[model samples]
Target: MEDIGYGLLDRAMIHQITERWRHGGIGIIVLQLRHVNAASLEAVQLWESQQTRLFWRYRMENDYFFFLNRMKSDRQMKLILDSAITSLKKGLQAAAAESSVDERAKPPFTIGTASASPSGLGRSAETMIYHALRDATLSMLRLRMKEDETELPFGSGQAGARSEWSSSVGIGILAKAIPTFDLHAQVSSLAKLFESNTHVQGAVIVNQGRPVGLVMKEKMHQMLAGQFGLPLYWNRSVEKIMDDDSLVVDASIPVEQVAQLAMARDISRLYDVVTITRNGKLLGAASIRSILECITNLRTEEARTANPLTGLPGNAAIQREMKQRIESRQPFAVIYADLDYFKWYNDCFGFAQGDALIRYTAAVLQDVTGILGGRGDFIGHIGGDDFIILTGSSAEDADKLCRNMIWRFDGGIKSFYNGEDVAHVVDRSGNRIEQNGVSVSLSLVYCDGSEDITTEHISQAAARLKKQAKQLNGSVHVMGEVFEKHLGEGRV
Candidate 1:
């Protein structure tokens, strides 16, 4: 029998080698055969028999041993397998190239474009044919190769899967990691409250039992500078000078958007800290230094409360805001705005384009909700294609703002939809696709501070109203007296 390479041995061959070693005593014969061979016929015969038996035995033991050992030490096995496969592949490639070169040396000639010489044309064509055949053979071999299901050492898929699973498991880790401030305590001025504590330059602000704004050093100085004639600078309430317009961020908002907002406003000198809140309650103040240190950390935490891709606050943040409104019992409207068919938009354009759409939508939200300028009431990114505008402003003001959002979004319709009458069909792939255009459906749920309404009731009512608005073909749905009647009836 020929000396079969290690690659060719099957399980049956391995078993046979093991059995022969046990019964024929080949191990003892090979160990003792060194002194008996001196070119004599009998000595040569014995030596040859021992060598053959040893070769099979080595294959059997190595195959089983390597397999069993690899189970416990997968990393080592992977290294070994990778090296072996690489070497085998290179050797096979070299062999194929040599075979091609030999075949090309005897090829038929054909007239061609670069036929300046007889040998050149034939050699070039033969080389091209050889390469083509080689590539096809390699591709087919790769397709036929079987992957071992048992081997999945480590890779992006595993890492991604682990990350997603960990994220799902550690959903509320951020809330636990950071300390939440008492809305009432946060409302106090750091300048006065910590007048003796020199290290405390500024303090976070809160309203309605939720974090809403900030009282920074600049604002403090501005207020004190005016009161130079009076000795009441320290005695004055920080609330009096608190910047209502100070950039406030929800814990759930993406840090990237927060960073972008801060950079755009140049908040470092104006207000160096980004105050985090939940439902208008103060969570903590994250400085520019702190934010930049671990952008990914803030991003991950924010993703839980915001959209993973768009960096917008998700339904959780919206729910928190709604709850705060209900608790305050303020007369405010919940304007639920949803982008029309954002999924198709995302699919039609690439994710990068979808990202642009989201950013544009955010800009629209920021522009329209500027009414809440410095006050706590304003707009929030409700993930994907949704946004919520909460304000103590009048219904007409809210309506005007929603209309402005629609108009501004519509103005960019040509760029987004490729001039195909937004509603008309255009080829997305092979099929004709019609986009619903950039339209917003608004639902307003009003609450009187005097009413005994709950956030849950308001949300449910808003959802119903949103459904109604979606029905009117790009119209706003006002929950009106029906929502108020429910509150009056004490059905909350």
Candidate 2:
């Protein structure tokens, strides 16, 4: 109402509220014109009575309210205003939901931003949102394509004829096939394998099948120098001399993660190979050159399978894993890990810091999962701070893992705070704000063979559990038999 008291319609209040709403991208503005002159009030009444132009006026005794000129009739003005407000509220809600979904879909290493142009292409907001969403959809398609491409044969396709190379190994190859060196074995013993088998140039040292370091001829020689060489080389164990600086890849690592590691090395400083493993058990090693080649091939074969920012497998991989689990009828748990207050965190910190935070989160997930047990376990980057882990374990195990992950990330959150006071402060526009604390919400679903589970079902279950967890101030929500029972009774 424009006819409110003079003090109530102060310019400062209007400016403050208007600025706040504008910065938040909210369009509605409110103003009050108090104590209108008689002539002006008469003009307003005349304008209202005509109702021919695109303007609507309402009166409360001496006070009058004028809506935008586009709205002609009083009824039309009310309807349009109501509709616009409703639409604006819906838009805000959708934006918030989309933000949450994006955070949950992204890999731990990929950062999310409000900026339209992710690659500095100068794209508009609409174009950027479309492309980002499109890229994510394409990534899913690529994952499906990869599944179709890597068709495993029911049986071995080819058999090699017995030759000198094949036969010479046949005599004792069976014995050598079994791993003999325990953690206590001498470094020389492991090195001897390379010497005994000429085909093996250098062996990457693995601990419980997880690549901890590499033991090359050069490193071995260095360890064998001087008077200490005799005792160390002759008796010292592999555990003592094993290099501990080897980089490792988990089974569910996206090709992008591997590519980034490879790209970090110069030609001279290049690694010979990258080792792949699951839960500390070595799967195999792909030579750096071979990995680079695979990446190139994958890009051509299915450009959309990989996340551009984090390079982790997309939703396609997640769905494929779910389908495989279904087909195999195995027991497995699905974990949906989401960072809490990530949007606020990103807003508080710069984009660079946000990127660093995402990378750090990914590293934490890798480190924790690398030690897990069981086969067919996978950890995939979905796209920001959301990650998916499929494991053949009970819900309890998943809960523990999720808790550990949260504890590990707490350090980074503290670092981000950097000793800032935990006090609410007003921004330039006088809006109250507080620094975000360390927190994550986890939704875990455990499905065994007996249950008929689908990806969509799992997703719904996880979503419900996530909501429950978030309600507890961002804690782990275990969704299994207990959750099912409660949900079945409509208790949730």
- Which of the numbered candidates is closest to the native, going by highest lDDT? 2
Per-residue C-alpha lDDT of model 2 across residues 322-391, encoded as one tens digit per residue? 7767666867788787876666666776777777777677667666766653444666667687887777
Query: Pick by TM-score: which candidate is best?
Result: 2
**In order, how many clashes per candidate?**
7, 7
lDDT of 2 at 408: 72
Relative to the true structure, candidate 1 reaches a TM of 0.37
- Name the weakest run of 10 consecutive residues (lDDT summed) in model 1: 108-117
Model 1 lDDT, full chain set? 0.45
For model 2 the TM-score comes to 0.37
1-492 per-residue lDDT for model 1 (tens digits)? 445323112344435433432332111111111111222224323433433222432211101111111222224433433443344344433443444233232111110011011123444422332232233322322222111111222211211111111111111123222223233442234544546665454565555556554665544554565536136645455455565666776665645456556655531232256666666666567665344324434334434454544444466655665666666655677667776556666766777877787777776666666643224554566666777777776656655666666677676655866555556333334444443554556666666667777766776787776666654544333445324432211100
RMSD of each: 27.9, 31.0
